[model samples]
Target: MRKHKIAVVPGDGVGPEVIAAGLEVLQAVAAADGGFAVESESFDWGSDRYRRLGRMMPEDGVETLRGFDAIYFGAVGDPEIPDHITLWELRLAICQGLDQYANVRPTRLLPGMQGPLRPELGEQIDWVIVRENSEGEYAGVGGRVHAGLPLETGIDVAVFTREGVARICRFACELARSRPRKRLTVVTKSNAQRHGMVFWDAVCREVLADFPDLDVDFKLVDAMAARMVTHPGDIDTVVATNLHADVLSDLASALTGSLGNGATANINPNAGVPSMFEPIHGSAFDITGKGIANPVGAFWTGAMMLEHLGEDAAAERLMKAVERVTENGPRTPDMGGQAGSADVTKAVLAAL
Candidate 1:
């Protein structure tokens, strides 16, 4: 049987709870599939570790992950720690360190789920947001130099490069081509942020030319956000800068159902380095230890990881199981049902 080594990082808050549930469902699917196996090792690197070690993860963390076939990450955040410290030090560090440039988020309204479904739009939402993960607005540029002065200033440069734009455009175009709609929307705030966003627009136009088969269009980020609510069917696949897509995907998720059901894949796309998959919902501290945190996102994320590992059959089985649960099984509080995480897990396992 083929085996895939997975590094499971269940970071902070409700992360551990949902990760546990996801692993159980993953293992169940693996057993039922019968042709493959999943071997996962847990890494406890998060806010608690930071409090003790003065770091979210050890220095050699990314290198350690290199040995694994893929990384299965839970959310990372803490109420005590500054959000920036928690995000940049752990998740972003690993993502940038590993060069996972494409942040793919797939959003689809599950059947029989109550959500912000726009009945007037005349179509159920299905969107894959391809965020330029490694750079662009989130390139980690600029600083706060005058900390204590009257002229105290902080600057965060929304950096963009031809190389970054070209690569992400190509990746998004290819993904759009793979889908049945063959449609893609490139988003940038070029009219307002002239230099960086215009650079983004120009580079994307140049790169998209290579994808002749794809039906592509460009829109300002704000207008795109509006379109998402007013005309969701007009969108199928989207490519945007890190910050833009990060915000948009969350909106996409809420439109479909809940953040608890949103799945994300931080993909390297190259052969050697492993990609990382995680739920889009962060640590969700309020729900920590409550045993009611939703596990659907993590389960969906697990299925994405399986697909990335070339286990398409197993991935399909896992997704169908999740759909079965969503369609006619227990749901957590996030989905307006009385069930706990474990209950949903049980339903998914039974579905498997």
Candidate 2:
């Protein structure tokens, strides 16, 4: 049997709760598949640990992750900790440290779920948002000088490089080529921010020239937002800067069903470092320990992890089981069903 090593990081709040449910589903799927085995090691590294030790993770955290075949990450944020501190120190740290530059988020309305959109329009929302993960607005390239003064200016530079943009564009194009649509929408803001975003736009066009078979279009960020709701079916594969895609994917999640059902994969396609799989839903502190946090996103993320590990049959099987549960099994509060996270986990396990 093929054996894979997995590093599990159940970060904070309901992260542990949903991750527990996801782990259960993962084990059951692995058992049912019989072609492979997953051995996991848990790393209790997050706000709770930060309270004990001043850092969210150890200094060598990224190095430790390098040894695993893949990483299954839970959410990483605490209301007690400043959002910037939590995000920069934990989640963004791992992503930038490991150079996991392709952040892929897939959104689709499940069979039995009700989206905020018109029911028929909801059915047409099947799109994948690929963010340029390692750079752009989240690049951490600015500074704040002058403390406790009226002139305390905090500047965050939106940094983009030709190489960075090209690689991500190429990555998105390759993904578009794989899908039946073979179409890509490059999100840009070249009208306002001339230097960096225009550079981004130019680099992407240069890269697209190599991918002659792709059907491509460039849409400004604002219009793209309206298009997502007004015409959700028009978008199939989208690539944008880190900031734009981050916001759009949230909107994407909302239009489909709930953030509780969103799944993300942070990948380093060219490197040997482990890629991270996570639910795009942040740590829901209000639902922490309530046993009602939706596990479908986590379960779906587990399926993504399996696919990254080359377990195609297991990944497809896991997603099928998820579809079965979401269609007719017990539901979670986020999904408008009264069932708790555990119940949903069991329903998926049973489907498996």
Per-candidate RMSD, Å: 1.0, 0.8
For each candidate in turn, the TM-score is 0.98, 0.99
Put down candidate 1 lDDT per residue, 127-212, tens digits, no spaces: 89999998877888989987899999998888787888899999999999999999999999989998988899999989887888
In TM-score terms, candidate 1 sits at 0.98
Q: State model 1's lDDT.
A: 0.91
Worst 10 residues of 2 by lDDT: 267-276
Top of the candidates by TM-score = 2
The local lDDT score (0 to 100) that residue 192 gets in candidate 2 is 98
Which pairs clash in model 1? none
Tens-place lDDT digits, model 2, residues 1-352: 9999999999998899999889888888899989889899999899999999899999999999999988999999898999898888889999999999999999999879889989878999989899999989989999999988999999999989888999999999999999999989999999999999999999999999999999999999999999999898899999999999999999999987789999999999865789999998889999898899999899999999999899999999999989998899699988888998889888898899
In model 2, state the lDDT of residue 186.
Answer: 100
